[model samples]
Target chain A: MAEMAASGESPEILFWVGCAGSFDDRYKAVTQAFVKILNKVGVSFAVLGPEEACTGDPARRAGNEFLFQMQAVANIQVMNGYNVKKVVTACPHCFNTIKNEYPALGGEYEVIHHSQFLQQLINEGKVALKGGGEFKGKKITFHDSCYLGRANDVYEAPREVIKALDVELVEMKRCRTKGLCCGAGGAQMFKEPEEGKKDINIERTEEALSTGASAIAVGCPFCLTMMSDGVKNKEREHDVKVYDLAEMIAKDMGI
Target chain B: MSILPQLIFLLVFAVAGYILYKRVSYLRRNIFLGHKEDRNDMKEQRWKTMVLVALGQKKMFKRLGPAFLHLLIYVAFIVINLEVLEFIIDGLSGQHRIFAPFLGGVYAVAMNIFEFLAIAVLVSCFAFLIRRNIMKVDRLAMKELKGWPALDANLILIIEIVLMFAILTMNATDQILAERGVDKYLAVEGLFFSGLIQPLFQGMSEGALIFLERFAWWFHIVGILAFAIYVTYSKHLHIFLAFPNTWYSNLQPKGEMKNMSEVTNEVNMMLGIQTETSNDPPAEIGRFGAKDVNDLSWVNIMNAYSCTECGRCTAECPANITGKKLSPRKIMMDVRDRAEEVGKSIDSGGPGLEDGKSLLGDYTTKEEINACTSCNACVEACPVNIDPLSIILQMRRYVAMEESGSPAQWNAMFQNMETSFSPWKFAPTDRFNWADQLKNEEAK
Candidate 1:
């Protein structure tokens, strides 16, 4: 973004590499997969790189409104400095915070989740899927992130993208608006869950496993990590794989 | 004189009306004790939401069987209440079937429809009771509903059944008297449900039939008045509040937590940034989040009262489903409990919120609030759009901001977020380090 601004040219969109997409070892792959799709499609997107900051979603949700505003204001200033108008992110947390919460704080943009962006790219015929990818004919379950599904009502876009892979989409008993949480929301990823009969991720993963799907697709970085941890807990990691929708799309497109 | 019965009816009606008014006024006063919020925007969307959710029972259809049963009761509640208007007029005027004279045959048809609705209400109430007691539906049978909530659920159903019986019995005896050519018994026709039981009164004499019919009449009307008063104190308050609650629902996306403009101004002033200009003075930042009921918004308090305690929220709650302490239903119940406690205290000329107890420690626990994943399944599951998550978030805010007593791990994450831009301890320069692998993949 800084280089583009220096050259007096703005990219088509600013890729908001959220904290998970940037720093988390596992989610970084989701970031890379999505970027590969973007590059292959020639979308001319630029990341904030070092200039990006947390959207204060976790802090705000944790009830530290002061910290949340500080982070939101700082991120807003940086994005506004770049004249950033459109944003796309793989993390539903960042997407929700920026799209819904930022407008009240003087930051507004056409924010799109990577799943929606992928759906748009596919509809426009920018990204094409192979006729017979490794996932074709195999059963895959899509876990709805609370932020993306119930929060924004973006249930269909992600499912449409998954169906484009030519894989049979199996739904958990609890799916769409009634989808179970992976238990990483509201800063639960940073801390241990309260004592319970079972971890939420395990509960969610069991639902996914019940569908007999070989792959569990997710839209949020937090969900990806939690579902992956859940698969490991069940020792089904060797058979069942958890992935972000972007990663699956990128792999299907052979990007 | 015949006016004697009229006088008794008037006295009962006035007393019940006054009691209901007092209860309603107390509820309104307690709700307003919470801080104000501007939900008046988006009149069109608010109307649509109220119509669809509260009026149309849209969300209830997510579960077909219960939704069907609930719809029967809901429809009966609305249509049968039209008869209450007639009952009120008859009670005050010392007349029997006042509307009967006005509409003639139309009145009998209306009466038949009302009878059918009464039977529907009876059937629905019976099904609900069976589901609660015999079937032991997990959601309704949860530990949160072990006491008054459980009794309250059964009591409302039993009352509705008894009320329906009163209506049916009143119609049956009135039909019997009209058959015997008694005066003022007003002839009616096509009363299906009540007519089915009319034969039981065939052998009764005139005086006995009149007494039984009059007894049922008083019972039906007085039972309705008492039910109206009792509803204000019960979860059945949802019948009245569901409209306003759905109208004033948070129209924004479910994931969007409310922004604190007060915090925004403070942050701007501290950083020397120009805040948005407004003629009104900067609002005071009272205790950060809600310590008690008063610190929350009026809509939040209304949400508490509007909750029907159906346990749909608790049933779908991820935390509660996993055996965690956080039942979203319990959160609303706690807020309502605390508000009622404070309201009663102030009424008695005692310290209200300063009674050495808070909603946090005394009513709801930090364990319960902390257990929430903010998954919003509970919010989505609410038929009337009661947002228990908002109350949970407010309590969480109180814990974090006022007490600075978030769990130690959360405090560490807060510290890390303060120093670095992220929740982890990584430097900002390394934020895009993950993208470096993209260039290597491109090289391949």
Candidate 2:
């Protein structure tokens, strides 16, 4: 943002690198993959760099309205200062909170998830993929993130992006509107789950793995983390791999 | 002396009407005990949702077999009530088959349809009974429904079966009497189900037939009135509440939790941010979240009443499926139960919300609310659009803000978010370090 302002130039969009995309070691690779795609498509974008703060999704969902508002107001201030008008993020948590919750705090912008952004790029003939990429004709299962699918009704975009890779997509028994959670929402990711016979992440992972797909695709950073943990728990990490939608697209495009 | 039956019927009808009125008012008063929530926007959308979800039974169709049987019973409930309208008019005007003379053949066709639906209701109720008892469907057989709830479900089915029999018996005996050319009896024929039972009444004496017919007529009307009164108390209230419940459903994207405007204003003031739309008076800081029934919105309370304990929500709940303490259905049941408890206490001049017990500890435990992933499967699974997750979040808000009672790990996480703008202890400056490697890769 500072460089753009110093050059008296305005970018077309702002890349919201959420806390997971910025700090989580595993999710940072997803952030890089998505950025490479943006560069490949010649989409002018600016990042907040050091100025962005958390969107307080966990704080609000954890029931701390005060903390949530504090974080929201602070973030709104910086974004408004930058005159940011369009934003995209790879994290459903950040995507949901900022897209839905920010307007009320005097910050309004058109926000799209990375899956939707990728689908648009593909639709506009910007990002072309290899006809016989690694995922071509291979079975891949797409796990619906609660925020993206049921929360905002963005079910088809991510699946469309995956189908563009020329792969056959399989569905779990529970998918779409009836999609199950990965046990990490509502701040459950940061706390020990209450006593239960089995963890929720395992239950969801078992369903995903039961689809007989060698690869699982996810849309949210939180879901990616929980599902990866579940795959490791089942000791099937060697057999099955998880990739974010952007990562898959980036890999297919050879960006 | 002929007016004696009409007089008695009038008295019975009056008493039943009075009881129904009282119950409806009681329900209204209790539902209004909660705070107000404005859901009246998007008028056209609300109607469309009500039509698709409540009237269309759209969500119930998620499971095929039960949904089919439920459709049968639901259709029976609607079509058979048209026949009840005839019964009501007959009992009031000292007439028999009043609509029969007016519509000529249409009445017989309608009665035939009613009989077919009555038979359908009987068969569906029997299937449900078997599913609930012998088949032991996992959702219906959960421990949450062990006692009164279980009995309530079975009792409703049994009552519906008995009511159908009453209607069928009246039709059958009336047909037999009509064959004997008795006065005030319609000479209806070609009745499908009733015809099958007509032979059972063939050998009866005229007076015996008359008495049996009169007895069934009175039994049918009175039982119908009694069922109306009983439904308000039973989970069967869904029949009525489902319409309004679906109408007032949360229409925003399911991912968006409502922002607390009071907190927003306070935060803006603390930050010294100026805004143009600050004309409203400074808001008072009410309870941060729902601590009891009254702290919740009226829509939240009504959601509790609209739930029918079908266990669809519980069955789909990841926490419950994983053997956790949280059952979304039970959360709704608990809220309704607590609302009733508080409403009753206030009626009797008791301490009401001050009765020392709460929805949190006494009805729902901290464990149950904490176990929720906010996945919204339960919300989506509800045929009537009951939002148990909203109530759960409200209570969690109470625990975190009012009592500071979240678990230790959550408190640490909260501290991390407050201090470092993330749930983990990482400096905000490192937020962009992930891009450093990307820069290096690009340089190559």
Candidate 3:
């Protein structure tokens, strides 16, 4: 990480802190904490400034391609000049856009979601975790993000790492590769959900609740917001908590 | 049977049939097989489309009116051909002019009408050729070939006209000297062909005219045989493929999406396409995701071969008119090319693989598929009745179900479908919240 930062040859991941991660400093801190762990293991990484503009995926979904492209090209050029060989982001949307969409417009780079990167780290023994935590013996079901699960096919790593950490990985009726969306993709976060039968995130949260887990564990920062809101709207906040994977992982590491 | 004549006909057509098969199959193999897509639902659509589409000409009125007019001539050709068959069998039964009188008496007018249509068909086909080649006029419905496509297409068109004209000439000449009196339409037959035919026969008496009629009979038969071969190689290839494509079209569901099944023997299992793995598919599949072209399946080629390129499919496509960069006609053409490519590879000792191409791709593009809004316009507009929408939707299924090649908006749509039975992906609270129990229950 330091070598790339100094020489400027290696591409910085430009990990967008995102609204959710920024608001929940604990998640942010843990995400940063994990980077330190990765750094110690000699896995190279970096962060874009905290105020880096939103990828505007939400704006694009609101039928505003101009805004989306503006945000996307700006980030792409920043990363392009850096010789970015790859980018890893905690957000599935950012990871996918940087990997799949940006390249279509002539920006090419190997982009992977953080779950994928984290899973690679864990699988390679570059990162390890201790299991004991404040939320011990609590059954939690993981909510797969559309960007990560369906879009990117990072089905196993999050569960594998979570399993290693001693979380009672409860399975929802719909989980893994075919997991539901959190209603947060397509710049949906910036606009009101289409007037429909139900909120997409809440529907997913109910499935997680149906799993009988004490908490809904999630991978995407946006999913964390949606599911947490779902718990509150459904008056289940007292019964089931929403935690980003980082927060749970940090707690297990005695952070 | 006169082994000599039969052998000559068989020999002519067999060589011709092989060439025709090679050409059509080449188009089926090379042209359609250029790209691949995932169309798992196409297995059933194969039957539905073939029956309702290729044979029924469901979209003929919706598109391809002029082509359909030409097709009507072709159909009349087939019907009138039964009369020709009746004569050949009569000849096989050792009679040349057996039905000559009855045909002259009863169906002469019908024969004359068919002849007129055949002539009109020839004219239209010629005009069409001029438009396609010289004028470079192209239907959004059919493939735009190379600037003046190889001589094969023009030759095929010429052959069709010549064969029809041969029938016209032979029929007219035979009627002139037949025991059934010369046809009234043969005005000045003597002034035109009498002198033309006389020089060919030295010291010919009136009885020699019978021999001339026999010669014309053989010539016309040869023309038919040649036409048979011409059709094999040309877009007229649709003559054969359309029937079967229509007969077996609705083999699968179009609107309802079947669940994805895990087949253990991936080695033996078939997918939507049977062709290339899209080294390059359409722009739609290419943009978001496309694995390879080999995954499209057998049915897409059936669509290509059966399509007459009547512009109906495109005329009805909502996406095409709404400024979306999509044309159902182009999609069919691409499918045909990609299909032909794959089929050719298989014939050339390449594996006839039906596997692993993305239904949605950066090649064919998510934008094009997403532009559909599933309006069924193209399906409704097909002439040989192609169901491109079924294939398009199945592409969506592959992306949504298998590859996650979906656009950003669909990500939420799938999420909604997962949470709620409806595509709305509704909240659980509101999912049933809109419902109220039957209050009266028949006044109970």
Candidate 4:
């Protein structure tokens, strides 16, 4: 944001590298993959770098509305200072909160989740998949993130991106509107599971495993983490791989 | 036809009316214990909601079998109450069948209809009893339904059956007396179901028949009054509250969370968008969210009263299905129970209870609330539109802001968010590191 202000010009889009994309070791690969695609396609984009905040989704959801508003206001001020308009994020939590919740806080932008942004790019012929390279004929199942699927109603964008990979996309029985949570939504990622018969992620992962897919594709970083953990719990990490849509796209593109 | 009978009738009616009035006033007072909120906007939509959901039973039909049975009882309960007006007049005037002479044939038609509804009510009540006791539907068998909730359901069914039988018996014996050409019997026709039961009075003499008829009449009237008073205390309060509850249902889009204006004002002030008024007194920035029923919005407290305890919300909850301790039905039950406890304490003592117990610790556990995902499934499944999520959020607010009792990892995340502008401990300067690597690859 300071760079844009110093240059006296804003980029075409602002890439919101959310917390997981910014810091988590595994999800950083996803961030790099998506960034590679954007750079290769020559889409003008800039990052907030030190200016970006967590979007306060977890704070608001954990019942600290005061903390959430504080965080949200700070971010909004920085973005508005930079005259930012459009935003693309790899995290559905950021996508949902920014697109839906931030407007009421006086920060409105044409926010798109990375899957939807990538699909738009592919449709416009900016990014091509090199004849469905690498993932051709592989059995892949897509895990729907709750915020993206049930909350915001964007079930197709990620699937469409996966379809571009030319993989045989298998679906869990509880996909789309009936999709189960990865046990990390509503700030549950920040807390230990209360007493229950089984962890929700384990149950959701079992459904994905039941499909007999060799790989599980995800759109949100939180789902990626939960699904990865579930696969490891079953000792099937060696058998099945988990990849974000961007990672799979970058791999297929050989970028 | 004596003044003595009239005096007895007035005394019984006054006692029942007074009890019902006291209960209603108590409920109103208890609900007002919560903070005020304005749900008065969207008048047209509110009316539509009342008619469609409460009157039309829109949400009830998701399960066809139970829906039809419920409709039978619901319709009977409503249609039978129309006869209560006639009961009032007859009791006060010491007259039998006062409207019969005026309407003549139409009176018989109405009686036939009432008799049919009485039979429907009886049959439906019996079916409900079997479902509650014998079949034991999963929603009805939740742990919260143990003891009084279980007995309350069965007792209501039994009372309905008894009340309907009393109506039938009174009508049946009245028909037999009219056959014997007794004065004031009126020889009313087309009694339908009651006519069928008239044979049970075949061997009785006039005086015995008169005694049985009066006994049934008193039982039916008195039972109706007692049921009215009992309803205020039961989950069956939904019978009265469903209309107002549905009328005031949240009209906002399901995904939109309610914004805190106080926080927004503070934010705006920080952003230089608004200036604070200098002359205003120091504002009481009380606890951030709800710690007790008094801190909650009045609509939330009313929602507690409107819960049917049918466990439909719990049945549809993902957390409950996945074996979490969170039960939306139980949450509402706990709120109502806590409200009752607080209300009773205040009634005995003064304005506030000296008891250290609160709605949070004594009634609901933190584990149950934390298990919730805020999925809105419970909100969607509620027949009366009770929002358990709102109450959960409020209680969680108390936990997070006032108590500072969030789990350890949450505290870490909160600290990270406070300093780093993200949930991770990494400095925000590295936020664009991933994008920079892409440019580095391009340079190579």
Scored by Cα lDDT, where does model 1 land? Answer: 0.90
lDDT of 1 by residue, B242-346 (tens): 999999999989998988777887787766788667998767778888889989999999999999898999988888889899999999999999999999999
How high is the CA lDDT of each candidate model?
0.90, 0.91, 0.56, 0.86
lDDT of 4 by residue, B127-170 (tens): 88888888989899888899998988888899999999999999
Clashing pairs in 4: none
lDDT of 3 at B409: 59
lDDT by residue for model 1 (A146-249), tens = 99999999999999999999999999999999999999888888888898999999999999999999999999989998999999999999999998989898
> In DockQ, how does model 2 score against the reference complex?
0.83
Candidate 1, pairs of clashing residues:
none
Ordered by lDDT, highest first, the candidates read 2, 1, 4, 3
Can you give the DockQ of every candidate in the order shown?
A: 0.85, 0.83, 0.01, 0.48
Query: What is candidate 4's CAPRI-style docking category based on DockQ?
Result: acceptable
Give the chain B TM-score achieved by candidate 3: 0.63
State in Å the error of residue B245, model 2.
Answer: 0.7
- Tens digits of per-residue lDDT, candidate 2, A104-192, equal 87889999999999999999989998858889998999999988888888999999999999999999989999889998988898898
Each prediction's number of clashing residue pairs? 0, 0, 90, 0
- Which is the leading candidate under DockQ? 1
Residue B323's C-alpha lDDT in candidate 1? 88
Model 3, residue B401: C-alpha shift (Å): 5.3
